[model samples]
Target: MPDTRHASISVDQFIPAPPAKVWDALTKPELLARWWAPGDVSAVVGHRFHLQMPGWGSVPCEVLEAEPYERLVYTFNTTWTLTWRLVVEGKGTRLLLEHSGFDLDDKRDRAAFERMGKGWQGTVLPRLAEVAAAEG
Candidate 1:
């Protein structure tokens, strides 16, 4: 039997902007292309997205659910699923991100998966916050 244990990494950021502002950073392909990949990289969902990282080449992403300034969910490589939720909080908005579905026995790949999770925190997400704050 294949190891199917699920692992999820999530991040929450409070951006000093409205929910719509933060939501645009997620759903807009232009904004996504800006910070979807790590520095000097780019991404385009519903089309081919090539990453500089070896063994992590072009992958297709199908947008599963998109509720405007509320939620956006999509599948990467038809295996990993990522969901982002936005909630209004006072003068800012709360952004919740979850990336799940990875192999349990593949330790080598696990590190890459974990690094992607961290990327959302260290890179992609912070830029979203900055963009939102700037628009606020």
Candidate 2:
């Protein structure tokens, strides 16, 4: 059966740091530890991570895949895989992220997908930029 239940959300940011530096922020655990989650929340490979917001309950997550200086892919609830792409542009890096393989038939999971979309925009991407700034 052809899978018809895949969903993807993407966002791009141009960071002032070079691609290598930006990539390090994305791939290095020390850098990720600083900006991978929201507020007092934190993250590590193989750790069950969550992002705490004012209203949203802790959003549970795990790091599914990570490739140094190039790509990172991961799953939440074992349902979707989110991939991040970093490319050198001018003196900085153009970061592109894609979240895929969501189950369309499940409404609750769909809500999570929606939240992931917002989180990337409101939380993760900005934090990545911040990490880039701090990387200097």
Candidate 3:
């Protein structure tokens, strides 16, 4: 039996750019394709989009909150609530990512959540830094 506890993933990263630049990489579909998944994403609340997840195919998403250059929250694949909070710090921006609402009771879901956590920390964040830096 898998652990029946709820789980969440959080990551913190500092990019060598302003909040607006980071926000652009996050909100703009073109920049997002460079770093994250390719999708028709917008900075508008309630906007629905799907990202091409390589082997996983298209993952459905919906924008829940869009607060300019400060914060953006969205639903990821109808399972997790992904939140991005940007804060200007000194000469760069601090990016706080929270991917929550994992059902750890199911083994498959738990494994997927763990893999996603690693993917976010390793691939996603680094690509985002590169894109944000290039945009800056």
Candidate 4:
């Protein structure tokens, strides 16, 4: 049998802003485009959208769960799911991201799992922090 084991990416980041601001950067399409892909993203369960990534093109996504400034869960592309949780800290928001549904036994999935892990930490989250911290 194949390994069939699953892998996931977890990113924890601190944003020098309130939960509401960070939440906006996640939910608001315009604000989100500054950090992430451009999409008609909404914090409403069952809402379907597509994110236009430069090299990746259009990625279909659907909102699964949304709890305002606390949590947001959604399906990315097809198999992967992205979950974001926000915890209010002393002077900012602590953002926790979990990207799951990686089948390590598969070559393509394994490569994506590895690359995205670094992408989230090195580029994505840092851009999100800057967008969330900006005065609006």
Candidate 5:
């Protein structure tokens, strides 16, 4: 028997803002464009959208779940599930991002998983924090 588990990536950040503010930044097109790619993202389930990845072009996505200022789950390029969990802590919020369902058996998928793990931590998360700090 061989291991048959999918690879996943997760990044956690503590934002000095409330869950509502963070939620707005995550869902609003203008705020998201400042940090991540420009997309018509919303908290409505089943709404299709695309994120303009700098060098990768537009990545198709769909909202799978939306729980107001709590949790958001969406699909990424029809390849993986991206989940954002927000929790209120003190006067701030704790954001946990989980990108899962990487097919480890595929070399290209594995490579992408590794690259995204670093990208989320080094680039995406930091930019999101900057936006939150500035806007919150």
Candidate 6:
């Protein structure tokens, strides 16, 4: 009748840089690749791309929403959705990430949810903060 599954990961981080710098680090391929996976990503809605995650293979992604220096949303591997929101705080930016749409009942998804949750919290977002703050 209806879907009743809910499993997501949220990563909120503060970067000591302007939204433009943080946005660039999120949208620009060079800067994005430096922290996250490498992809032909653009800050254009509806643009489909692939993020190459070395050992994990290439994952298809599509830009669902893009608001420069404010917000971004995309689909990861068809099912998962990654939504990023940036809020300007003084001269810095408050970065928010929501990685959703996990079918926790499925073993694979559960494993990935746990693994990626760790990855995003432990490595990905911290690196993004560094890369964004370092952007000049």
Question: What's the lDDT for all of these models?
Answer: 0.70, 0.70, 0.91, 0.94, 0.90, 0.91
What are the TM-scores, per candidate, against the unseen true structure? 0.77, 0.70, 0.93, 0.94, 0.93, 0.93
Instruction: Point out the worst 10-residue segment of candidate 1 by lDDT.
Output: 38-47
Off by over 4 Å in 1: 1-4, 38-55
Q: Candidate 1: TM-score?
A: 0.77
25-133: candidate 3 lDDT, tens digit per residue:
9999999999988999999999999989887799999999999989999998878889999999999999999998899887877988879888999889989999999
Name the better of 2 and 3 by TM-score: 3
Better of 3 and 4 by TM-score: 4
Q: Is candidate 3 or candidate 5 better by lDDT?
A: 3
lDDT of 6 by residue, 1-136 (tens): 6676658999998989999999999899999899998999998989999999877699999999999999999999978999999999888999999999999888878888889888998899999999988885
Clashes of each: 0, 0, 0, 0, 0, 0
Native-referenced Cα lDDT, model 3: 0.91
Candidate 4 displacement at residue 113 in angstroms: 0.8
Root-mean-square deviation of every model: 4.3, 4.0, 2.6, 2.0, 1.7, 1.6
Q: What is the lDDT of candidate 6?
A: 0.91
The sequence of per-residue lDDT tens digits that candidate 5 reaches over residues 1-136 is 7557587899998888888889988999999999998999988999999999877799999999999999999998868999999999899899999998899888878889879999999888888878987886
Model 1 per-residue lDDT tens digits across residues 1-136: 7556657788998888998878766655565555564222122334333333337666556667777788877776656877889998998899999887776556855886768777878887888888777656
Q: Locate the minimum summed-lDDT window of 10 residues in model 5.
A: 1-10
Worst-scoring 10-residue span by lDDT in model 3: 1-10
Which residue pairs collide, candidate 2? none
Residues 7-100, candidate 2: write the lDDT tens digits: 7788887888887777767655577667773522122346555544345566566765565667766554456666778888887788898878
Pairs that collide in candidate 5 are: none
TM-score of model 4 relative to the true fold?
Answer: 0.94
